[model samples]
Target: MAEAFMKPTVILAMTMGLAVSARTVVAQDTERPERGREGVTAPSGGAGSRWGGPGGGQQPWLPPLWTALDANGDGVIDADEIARAPESLKKLDRNRDGRLTMDEAMSPRPGGMRGPGGQGFEAGGPQGQRPDGSRGNERFAPTTRADGTLDLAMLWSQGRAVGTGPVRFSHPPMRLEDIERITPYGLMVGGHVCPIDHGYFYPRPLTPGQPHFDVMSPADGHIVMISHRTQLTGSTEQQRDYDDYALHIEHSATFYTFYDLLTQLDPAIAQQLDDATRDRFARRQMGPPIHVRIPVKAGQVVGKVGGRSLDIAVINTEVKLPGFLTPRLYGHYAWRVHVVDPFDYFDEPLRSPLLKLNTRKVDPPFGKIDYDIDGRLVGNWFREGSGGYPGDGRDPRGYWMGHLAFAYHHVEPSVVIVSVGDFGGQPRQFAVKGNGPDPAKVSAKDGIVKYELVYAPVNSSGEPIELPPHMRGVQGVLLAQVLENRKLTMEVFPGKTAAAVTGFTTGAETYER
Candidate 1:
């Protein structure tokens, strides 16, 4: 049976209505001890009040244990109760004295890695036993015997660590319903570029007016540097997409050079350009910088083009690997343009037109995908219908924007690799690989490509695990999807049978392309 824990909010809300106003007793049921904690042992036949007296002790801490164990309304644990107690009760003997004191029973340490008695013992007893084991030393495990009596011993023997106290039982810091905004770190830049006469570049149709889109920056940022006639010194393979239009952008920490944009600009814009920029423009080598932030607003025109699309090429940005230097997109690169559905950013009227074309009606044919068990924002999807093109291209036979793969192992950190590909036939591969930890592996079987990359474990909020530090580990799986309504509807659960695709879902998403 699946176990469920109450959310902190639910627990707090329930306690609010159940709490009773305290009534002042004309005479105290039991005389107050000069100085002692709750659950203190009382002399035999004394007042049977809470605080470990008779009437089945009712101190808030371990009330059930005290009530059940202290049979015949005696506050203290006599030899009879100790004899029938479970093995876990022995752990509360902090001094190794083999007897549980009020202080030891009241205090519970953190859960999970924290074991009983402050020693690294397993949190609970073997399975099939009652819930009396130490689950991370914090809360007690609730258990009952066959006779319907609250079994204090069974709780101690079978308790399993759940989580740290107070914090664990409290409501999560951020609930899923409270969050409204989601951002995509990956962005794609689109524009026209001319092929260099240099070496090692991929083949293109090179049509006179064909537009190119690259999985780079969605838009540009402030210009920080410019160069004129900078010697195109790298070898052809290293400078594959070389453009004399090199200039740096601040927002994305990257560079760009658009070949077709140089001559089209008016003198007003060109006068602001540096001498080097003007000189490069005169030679028809580069264009002025166009800075724009990502998640471009719908209907917001940053530039006007004569063609239906733009051609994007991955240009040169030097990266230093252990053994050598190579050209790559710098910083945290995101291919958002390809991975995100354009409709997500549009207003209802704007998004409505696209939805009508999608054919899913009533709502956009989309869903949100989350991992880490916690409610961390991952990515969104739109069902691939007849009118829609796979925005983050996974369609093997068509021009695709990108491809992503995940590899998982029981032991080793999980790995996620996202790469972009072409619109060609089957058996396509990515031209660039993202930077990740070591021990990554890649393979393919039956047309499905698999890559093993580093994946660090996350917390309840889906952020990387850190508080306990040692709790972090790796996990990964290959993602294979089935599409509909021009969007992704379901994916093959990795590690299971290759053909088994189950579960239906939809939502607005931005990451994990």
Candidate 2:
């Protein structure tokens, strides 16, 4: 199942990490001798490290799906890749049905597109769009050899295997020595209000003219996935858009790391993707994932981030954190289910420095994402019947509007957050009016609990600014009733004070765990 979900990432690993092809390997050997990848080559490991097709052992009933579409084996499907698509796709009628279903389209065998916790791809973004918007976890056609490892010698060459065992990261993803502050893993701020944050954001000091900061590979692995996102900055009339490149590196069959919000890409990495996709990025338009399998070693310069902070996510399918009453609620952003504390994932010396830069002061200073408890208001809630996390199979962007969560502030766990998905017709989060009636203790026996919602301000970098309830202006009032362990009802009166809101309105909506 893990491998099935992994097929979308292999090609991405190649292009974003090491785009220097065999013809340019000699030229790259001297481009920047200081970076440590001179005459770089994917390490030729023993036969034991070979990628054992899908799940490393189990096989599905049908032939691999992507193997049909990406006939040339470059790992992605884009304008440049169109040449090979026709022939391969013509042969994709594996079941002789003359047409393909969502299942058939994602098969490297049926499970290839399976998301975290092994859910179908149907729950993801709109038609033809990769899951998780443009920052998809998976992309590209298979650039892997029969055994699975990307045969870098030739896009489809029968190359030897790579080390597939778990490895310790000898270095941190970024140079933490000069970093300013690292946001907690699950801080619910800005656009990330519910379902929590799946990764951490790294902010650092940049020199007057040197806006680019070096991002590194923490361990030896293949750069398997890359996605280009369109971001806007400034006011409507003067708004400017830029490309935020998100890259995923595969450390082993079971472990991987995702880094995004990058404003710059190393030349070698940039040259790997098709020109069309690259041009889209230049135009500030959402670009699709371009797949490749580039090899990288620990501490290698992966890319560069401008003055903005860098986003990092680490996932290991082998372990599942105990929280999230319904795993399917998180299927659209599926990777949320397998997130781990990055500080804990790293080796000692490296992790210690990273932890020092973190702003969270709690016991697990890194913060937590899985806050759900079956019968409590301290987790996520779904509006009665709105398809939970992935939304109602309509628009993916507004899906979270129906998702509500009663969790703690990511940076300061002491404060309670009453985040509503469709609060007063839109999603918004607020600190409890007086920070009373902690969500962990609130229950059906408590009767109707009145929570005054307020608009918390976040700093320029998107981290919520710590403020007292009295100082933060009140935005509205929320009246909630916990009916049972798994059921509740809530209604909001925007721009109204507690004195103005007396009881539940007919518009009150029901929610469930």
Candidate 3:
């Protein structure tokens, strides 16, 4: 009964792991969590290795679909239990209005956009001073460009731009032919931003005996972090299988690289993973990050990948992108400010093929992520008064409750996505039900505009399928008004239609660019 403007990550990633041919995608996450955690299999097929069939056949940023519909704790949905749809969907309708609203359909996220624990996406600040004019703690922040999207600092200290280090990528992360598709940096899928490249493997539609490839280091650097993890897959016990892995690597303070979907960690560094506690991996979760410092050579193997995709992203601390809008809000995911194209740093011969594999038609072959346009409704917005990335040092409502973005679909830039950190008290994203009153065209003078939210599906190549009535599956409505260029107000009405709502109520929330 309920679908999405953009299907959950797996659904959106058509034939992901089963790569007969290579494809290119656009891509996030600063320092992210492990790729896929082991979890119970879902019967009706969703994201994550095709609903728990095997290794995560997804890019690092395409979050697996987590659902409340897996009733009975059995990880499945049966036909006889079909009657539960209405009631199941109703639970998200907080006010019992018989209709769903944006907030009602969403749930609260503990952290901001990224759930994986880390240092934080934004920099705390080095020359930073406290509001009271007192000296602040030693912190790191990025230097940015005039556009507010990226920075080109020479080196750095505490996330600030000091200057650039001599960063030269020697070896390729993987053999060029080993990859099927290279999802470029800056993608919008599953309602979030992907600030890195997701390299899908070759030999489409993997099997038990599928051959795996080695993930190597691109430069000589010490290992900084490793996401040691395991995942359970299969639709039933008889066919069930599992995978264990450790995804690792990072060059230096100036140049950073990350990998995901690794099935094994090179023995040398595997022993260095910390003795930390971790829950059984689940489809929508990542393993806890293990901190370590191990040196590695440029061509040395760091890990391995076989049945799924391998996520590869390179970040240059020397530069920060301004499109993220509020740097502090994204502190935990620090790399967001400086992510760049690996091709730019790679050795010539090796670099050419990787670039050839890219499918993005954008200006920079690497693709673009930061979309914040100062006075327009086309970028990220933070709730007013919300303390940077963490939030107003208080209750369950943190960065998630205050974060919001009006971005594009990662696959199809033309499709508009209205992402909200909190709507009707929960987090979710949507497409205007009838796909009207575009966010880009609505300015402060537009006053208050109403939107009915619905799911608009896309095709195999990542293009929207405008099937008219089929795409008009209304689930909720949202009321938003751009106060001025940098400020706005919003409210959600679950299970309601645009005509059913007229104005913002007392509960309306205010947001800033």
Candidate 4:
């Protein structure tokens, strides 16, 4: 499966909803302790509360176990529920020490590797039970009865350290050196670049004439190119078409800040602080920052250049930032490169020439072409917005503009290497080699070549943050479709088989290429 990566906005948005739901559940539990009493420990087998059984005892207040074990309302703790319990608790109490009090638990001495309790043993139970059970200070035996209860017993035995697996690539890692630039040879059409922080950077100095940019596979494989001609023309009929090909494009953006005037003045010390300090103080008074994930929708269409319609599919939609208080936010200025397959075409006419371009220009024939480049602003999200405050509505002027690049893939002899950027300007590089379709099966340490690069936050002076496992990668299949009205939706997944993006109008010609 191709690794898939998304802007932080999506991650923030998904996590926000989860955080809110979690807090809500916590609040509900606190408000109604007895609300789920029947499910935790029921009396006898008559659907008794989890705490009411003979082996269990009921507590007046909702026991922490109640909240921990009651994943579903259908009461009665099950094996799955028990398994979900904190690993710390299960490993420390070999004797099933009903409670994990600080004293009863083992502690790692000052400079010792093991805390009060030996490593892993801190959760209770025996240490290890391999063939040579005499490895560590703890031994564990899985208990099973006809009734199907899973319990562990602690036995004094030696424990061996767990074996480590080979490192693997979660996604195809790329660096600037791997990216190859394609010099534009076509007419300069209308185009826009919006970088999140710094604006556009052309290879050669910009002059009066139109400048074109393109990207080719650095590894000398298939080349995908998107071009736009610069000319003043009428609004030509928008055509939607697709071809089985990998698409690549560069984007640019500029960063700008928008202030929230409502939260500017402080009533208590009306004239105490200067304008700038007062502005800062007012922002501080808000709440923590909120991040939102804006979902990108895809669409499709099939028709001749002058005659075409669109069909759209809202693959995914999410808000990366919730409303919050913050001064300056940082995020990616992105341009989407959509790979599509041409199916068919339709006949259509220009809607508005001024808004579009050249309404009366001759239509081009459709076939398995590499690219048809276009430009527009997708969406934006605030990273660490409001500097960590709530109820503050200060959104910066976010734009998308950047250079374009492309990559190629082939299955003939199973060899893939970047062929373009190694000799010129900064380019991103990635390598993937494996015996089977599953890229994850390819160990990161062997049969693979990868690169790592650091990206500084949009507007921060601090050191760059190392990308975590979740944030550092993406894996998935890329799919695009053209819908009625020139709409297009592009779908990206973590692996070959993963869920599709949900929400957003992706199939409109307004956004698709």
Candidate 5:
């Protein structure tokens, strides 16, 4: 028999540090005043009101149902008046029952009271109704009707994942046990798809037209060539270091835009044909065209007109690699480019010996370690930020650190083992540094890494507490010490007074590359 996953249950125990209580559900009807009830007024006063009001009095707070109920137009409400409104009558008779019972009126329909695609309150017995009869803890709760249908308006009002937000693309509600059965390889949430590898390495495939390359040595770095047609390029590197040490590298890239040359290469892109992209390429009316300009070793402008000159470089531009990954670890790497006119380009990982290089181990004089998190060494978190809109003037347009980073092509989700520490610094300040396989020589199928972390909290007294065999409803913090040769005490802040402080640890392994 298939194991049933446990459904998320609302725990209402003082020991659990949750304050939840059952409450009575009630319904009430209000009367409309001639001048509109207090807190109810026209959006605009007097003549500005588009629709005429009762006796020329604007009624702003009148809900559509209430408006429909006010059939007599006396600017007052009563049972007779409500009965006269057909729409209100239909709404009140939710089950189509002759009379409106308290249960029928209060119970939400399968589709919910909100419109289509709306999010509604969680369905079940009413819980957590305040003395004033308001709901709390609704943020994490699903908005649903009593019958389990979602409220379309509420869902839409919650907003869709537009640019970027956590929880976007998250899996729908499922029982904890069922999650494993349905998503054996993990699940995709918030636009991120996490496939389960169960501690295996699987490389992604390279797109067409891109060549394979490798890193022969650290000094003999690979060269990246870019052209108008080449939008993106990606490479992977893996290495193994026995001793743990922090690594940092400085890098830069140059971008070239041919304002005048683009005008001549493709007149359509040069002149904006549509008002929408008037400042962009002329092909704005038609779809933008892709133009590739390969630079020769030596070149001079053969023709000059309209203040336009065409010049290309052996290597168009460069960008620095942020923090390094641990050695022997295989992870996907790629560079993406967005062309102004033509389609975007992705320089897929190359699988060629020409780009391959053996990494040379270098030993830099150790700098004095200043920061350290005093705790059992468990795991670490490192990230090379990616996938975000270009920075604007106010904010540096680039990926923000701490956004969950993973490869899209990989068949399995990338495991990230984060070591919780008490070092009270900005989160995501740690780095992973090491060498790995030459990206040019390895295929996407060969670059993969698996990692996971388990955290246990310790009490404020620096004593480890045994958590209940089965515990829930606890939140805490972890700190780390980053500076070399420095010991720093870290603390975990568990909201539960009786919560245990069990240390946590994470395990990770690299593959292929």
Candidate 6:
């Protein structure tokens, strides 16, 4: 299974280290005459060192065979040439699959260089032994014919037997398991957010032709919004620069935001897409998040972007408030707290299982599980419903109200709003209580779990002089759940309702455990 998951040898070599290709080696040799390749013409430099070094049975032995397979006389042997060539098909296609896959083509045959009887150089039967009863581990020169040069017969014989036993490769397909193994919290390979040629600072101007990296959905979810060509042109920066392509997957528990995609369109095709589907694409460009809720499997190609540099932010909208909040006795003051790192939940392997567990025995097993909220509330938490912000609706521009930290113990739980440059001042907490019939029970059933939480008007103090009415005293009903045992997604609706489903939400909150 491990071998089945590995990538092709050449790609594995390239990514594993700085193994140059045959063309690359030749180009380098051209510049530095001293490092010229004499008879060694195979892909045999940095990569060979990974196994045992070129001199120690790692040398590229089949020059003539390589040349023959490379129909265009190119240094590399591509899949097309291998498929068309009858010699390669007969000798390499071990399973008779007709088409040549990378693994089948690179796997070793029972006999070396020669078919069973043809004599060029003979290695032991899959045990790395030479015909002379010596171990093939020690490098031995290939025997030449009476003419003292290699011929087609000898080349075919030796090439057929060569095997890559020691060189194991690993480039797993980007499935949920593979992705979790590689980057549980999602990857930060691309640099921080980029706003085109604009300076590297907050509130940079947006531009078209910005680069976006191609990505598959990490899990099953709907494609709620996709922004291309860069601007919504609304009143605020949140509206103007709020352009970002996003995938809402995993039951809306997680969403991936792709920023700074390039302005390239897909190639002209024989068939055109539907109007509604084509409309989602920015700049009339083809590809990606084309439709809502198109169920895609792990590692399936959703779309590609034009840029090499990509910024993918995974926002887990599931947030849970800490349990054990006790009333305070001392003076209350705002305390600045850091937002929880998005990837921190991944550190706890128990929070997420690596493999799928057997759920056949448990009826309706994998939906929303009862979440135990038992940790400190000290990480970033975003209020749903702002463009580029969590939640829904198209609010113009608003303050970033960075990550929040709520200390529930201090008199009236202190709240801290993260800001730019300088630290924020003190914070004031809001009223949060269980919405159970008893109003004291901390836990509730899976469906219709309710929470009574009040919205405040000021940033740090209860004294509200004057501010936007939107920030005024507001009371609402909450639809809450501990989703996937990792975080919570709660939808706040106006008025105290008891239904399992709701029409719309005034606000939303995702708290990570």
Best by TM-score: 2
Off by over 4 Å in 5: 1-278, 281-291, 294-427, 431-513
Clashes of each: 53, 19, 63, 160, 76, 32
CA lDDT, every model vs. true structure: 0.24, 0.54, 0.50, 0.20, 0.20, 0.27
On residues 313-341, what C-alpha lDDT tens digit does candidate 1 reach at each position? Answer: 22212211121111111001111111112
Winner on lDDT (1 vs 6): 6
Q: Write the per-residue lDDT of candidate 4 for residues 201-236, one digit (tens) a residue.
A: 112222355322221111111101111111111111
lDDT by residue for model 3 (309-413), tens: 676666666676767665554433434566676677877877777776665555466666677766666677777876433333232332256667776655555
Ranking by lDDT: 2, 3, 6, 1, 5, 4
Write down the worst ten-residue block by lDDT for model 4.
308-317
Tens-place lDDT per residue, model 5, 209-228, is: 53221101111111111111
**Superposed Cα RMSD, model 5:** 27.5
**Backbone-clash count (model 1):** 53
Cα-based TM-score, every candidate: 0.21, 0.64, 0.57, 0.15, 0.16, 0.24
TM-score, candidate 3, is 0.57
What ordering of candidates by TM-score runs from best to worst? 2, 3, 6, 1, 5, 4
lDDT per residue as tens, model 6, 102-158: 444433222433422333223313244333222211122223233222221111122
Give the better candidate number (4 or 6) by lDDT: 6
Candidate 4 residue 438 Cα shift, in angstroms, is 23
